[model samples]
Target: MVSTTSKWTWKSPGDETRNQIDCMMISKRYRNALLLAKTYPSADCYSDHVPVVGKFKLKLKKNSKPFTNIKFDLAILKTNQTIRGKNQISVQNKFEALGDAEEVEQQWKNFKSAIMEAATEVIPKVKRKAKQKWMTEEILNLMEERSCSKGNKEKYEQIHKKVQEKCNMSKENCINEKCKEIEQQRKHAPQTMYSGFA
Candidate 1:
């Protein structure tokens, strides 16, 4: 059994990794019998760790048999008729308190806002390369046609510049100095782009 109250439990996994709770592995070097409840004391606090629980008396054999060390590896099964009846009533009240459609809609909006912050604000953007990369013509066309906000357009363009750098490409070939007749370039010196960066 594992303690639920232990805060040093779940290790924050990397982005794009599957969401999985940390599992509690039983110790294998035991010389004697081991009880489930005896191993894990804070069973009520852990929301994920304790996979099993129960209330049963031990009936250990005198002989050291295999798998006999585990004294009941299961949760206590309760089937009280009165408790079930009360639970139905409680569940109905809980559902009723959930309010109506408008509240649910607002909740959905809040969820969307959270998703945006997590994906956009928190996670560092990683640029990927395409074998058939979008040419300047395609990008220019996209800029002219896309209906995103100006801020979003600028952010996306910056990300694109980083992506270009990752593929060992540069715009130095395109940027001609002091050629006003052709397209006038920006004043700032172009900076180098880095890996996994945006």
Candidate 2:
């Protein structure tokens, strides 16, 4: 298909000549789904050929599962001493009440049920806070400002730098927080940390 930008995709180093050698191909069945195809001349790729980008519109089917497992927010148990003590006591009491079973399988089932019941009664489920954990309102605002200043090169560059700086800072902070959490887990629950690798 023809590129909308009408820019050459390749250049000769010696002669500085440009050519549209690159092309995008699509299957006949999905050809109509292509919205736009273009070459970006200003892209920072250190190659002879410029990058070709294509936009397409497609309908994706959602596969919903019949059942989903619930995840408990166990971090609360580590942070709150009272809840941790309560959960331990509840599990211990339940185990004591379970008594002896006829078979090993029956004993295991009883123990599992007791733990599940205690967890369900005491622990809270995990809650989704945001789609992107590292993204903040300030970074989003800078991105919006960059998009708005696209027509003005100077303004766009200024905002783009700011956006890059903010994104790097936010990502670094998120990584640092994650590292701290890992260190805490390593110190307090070394077995759990090693179990994750398994």
Candidate 3:
């Protein structure tokens, strides 16, 4: 292939000519999410054409469900007698204060509001925690290294192998940990285990 400073996407082996023939096509909807799209010539794919990598920073919209966010930790009510009693008293007082509504719908709304208000006042909210992922920081770093060393075939290949190995090991470890957790739950809290499946 013809040696040049500029990056080329493809190289004709027989003719020793290089050209940027490959292109990336993305939807207009996700145009803003496209951070970078480029070709890496040193990537050892054992082919005339190089790989085109596209980096995206996607802002996914969360699924909106009715009354999903205001989840009160009901488990606390089961464990703490004081909180349960307070909640009961609060609901009773609210219901009494609500009086009689003219319509059935209004009465139902009032009842629902009363129960929600009482729960909000007495029960602690369930804190939304980020879901745990199988991918580890070490694996991520290795991937980053591989991306960075894409200009050097030897370095890229080395890091790529390491990334694959780390990914497999991490996935296996995550699976084993989950299995152990399930076993423990099955032994100690069989009801909870069954409920999880349901």
| Better-scoring candidate (lDDT), 2 or 3 | 2
lDDT of 2 by residue, 146-193 (tens): 876889999999999998998899989987887777788899997675
Model 3: lDDT of residue 160? 91
TM-score winner among the candidates? Answer: 3
Off by over 4 Å in 1: 1-102, 133-198
| Per-model TM-score versus the true fold | 0.18, 0.34, 0.35
Candidate 3 residue-wise lDDT at 3: 27
Candidate 2 collision pairs:
none
Q: Write the per-residue lDDT of candidate 3 for residues 57-133, one digit (tens) a residue.
A: 99998868664457789999889999999999999899889999999999998999899999989889875442447
lDDT of 1 at 103: 78
Q: Report the Cα RMSD per candidate.
A: 27.0, 16.2, 15.5
lDDT of 1 at 22: 48
Give all candidates' CA lDDT scores: 0.40, 0.83, 0.80
Q: lDDT (0-100) at residue 194 of candidate 1?
A: 23
Each candidate's number of clashing pairs is 3, 0, 0
Q: Clashes in model 3: which pairs?
A: none
What count of clashes does model 2 give? 0
Q: Using lDDT as the measure, which candidate wins?
A: 2
